[model samples]
Target: MTNSEWRMTAKRDKVLSVSAPVPPEQSIAWPRGKGRALLPLANNSDETIRLHLRGEDPDSACQFGFSLPGEANKSSGSVTLELSPGQVLSLPVSITPPPPSLLGLAPQTYHFTFTVINLSQKERAWTVMGRLKSKPIIGPGLLGVTGICLIALFVPLYRFIENRENREDAFSATPAAEASEAGALWPLLNRGVEQSAPQTPQLAPPDLESLTYEAMFKEVGAAYNLDWRMLAAMAYQESYLDPMAVGALQEMGLMQIMPATWNVWAPKAGVSDPFDPYSNLQVSATYQVYLREYFSGKGHPGNKWMLAAYNWGPDNALQVIESGADWGDVPLHVRRYVLKIMQTDSHPVLSDPRLQESVGGVRE
Candidate 1:
């Protein structure tokens, strides 16, 4: 069988399998300004599967981008693709080079890995590897020549200046009387300044629990065209503003997001540390936006369904909605999560003029 059509027989029912052509062992030399490439994937199993794709380049010299099956055409670092049994697909993978200004004199080789995970079986997955070569605008040979010329020009001048300065220092040494006079003048000039200046009291660090993280929440929420208050409320409900809090399911940081969620959305949100307050808030807001769009496409009410999906996974939330049940009919925990956010006293976020306008000035 051709590489594209190679299949592995299923050993058990409800098993999902995937196969892809091995990436070339030799590096794929990407030109400085090139945009992207396509990677073909095939689902060779009896079970339908969801694919969560994530890419990482240690040096971060290039941005990896892809689009999911149901998402808009925009490229992101993380995307979810649904593959039916016996389906073959060609997915576009984009490699965005660093800006010309950021490139160095020497050529750069970026090694990246794209990890594909079956969401249903988190532990089962595969990875594809690729390399990008970015040739420098000014090659190393030219740079070495320039450096040698600069050193040749400055070395004599530096030596002459240094010798002349030493001679001057030897000949123009300050007299003892003059030094003593200068020291006397220093005390006279500074007399009573220390006594006259008022003391400024030191301020203590702000309490972590009381900190609103308002600026970060507002920025992230605005980026996704969401209400800052709702985002703040979600954070408050999730971890009570504690960036280091851990949930029962091992969810970490202020948003209580699982590591799986972090792996997928952190790249898309342009965040490196999910434990950081700002990064956590940004990733959480991005996931909220995705959930909102996904549920809205399924004919569910945007606000309530989005909140439900944020608590329970989108798949479960949609199933409840499809069964003719509204937000009130959701599971107890999810209902409580939605109700808590809706009733939260978000005075701080609501006080902002931009947020006020976005939510029609609603006050709880």
Candidate 2:
């Protein structure tokens, strides 16, 4: 899966009145889902400014060109311009139809973000969105997308409702305990000081040891409210504490993080150096929290589900569950992987004794 639309964020708050495609399709996308139009970029501020402009397509469905002063259409490289007050420049945007593999039955939106920076280095990002709708019974492509959608959407709901009934029955025995357990569903979201904010000032890499993958893991786990020992076990399993480890799937560094995973979480953790021990740990920890939260919402909480989801892709893990598989029915490798990590959860650690109780139990 490519970067989701939610990952695209603006760099600043200043406003720009960027016009949409010439004839905007407010109802549906263009006929063949291909559109070419000039988007207006107007500088409404009072100051005359030198600006640098570039565009990004997380959707990978669009091509961009800039019309500079002496250059009519410049593709590929960013362009520089000096715009006085009330000056307007046009950006040519072309959205090509997405390939069949990129489509999904629940509908997906595509984003093309334009970023502009002034001489003072004040940057801002503006984005345009195109949506793809579901067409069932069209062919195998649509049918396959529908099948994936059912697994992604319906199965999760079924698990959630089923878990709710279980929770109600368990809580029936004790009123006080019920209220307390109910809040576990959103521990970080309900109240977390620095964790909830997506934009974090870059936390400096720890200096204990250049080879200190353990220190990096503990630091990240503490910041994210995870069990440091458990996280360390995951790293030990993935890379054997080797900072330069490379996985068979092209995943890199201490955590063996996939390139796609790094692309999604790097910005959230406010780091760019993929191979740096601390940077790698930050991405892994952040994604772990996301995965845990996602599984919790799907009615599967605790380390077993979280670790299983981490080992196998969450979709595959859920598919196994939706197929009515028990722990014995999980793929042998995944079961062994999760069991090893859980076994290591009780290992002693020196970093923070306070996180001792954070090692989670497997849901029944």
Q: What would the TM-scores of all predictions be?
A: 0.40, 0.41
Tell me the tens digit of each residue's lDDT in model 1 across 1-364. 2222222311122454333312211112222253344455666677787878877778766676774454454456777878888776656566666744333555566666677787767657677665555556565644655565565556545655665577588775446734554454444334434433322211122233444467556666666787777887777778776665656554766788876687677656644444456666777877887888787788864678888887888779878778887666778988878877876464443444442222211110
* Residue 160 alpha-carbon offset, candidate 1, angstroms: 46
Give Cα-based local distance difference scores for all models. Answer: 0.59, 0.57
How well is each residue in 187-241 modelled by candidate 2, as lDDT tens digits?
4333333334355335664443333445556677778888877888887788766
lDDT of 1 at 221: 67
- Best candidate per TM-score, number? 2
Model 1 residue pairs with clashes: none
Number of the predicted model whose lDDT against the real structure is largest: 1
> Could you give the C-alpha RMSD of every candidate to the true structure, in order shown?
18.6, 20.6
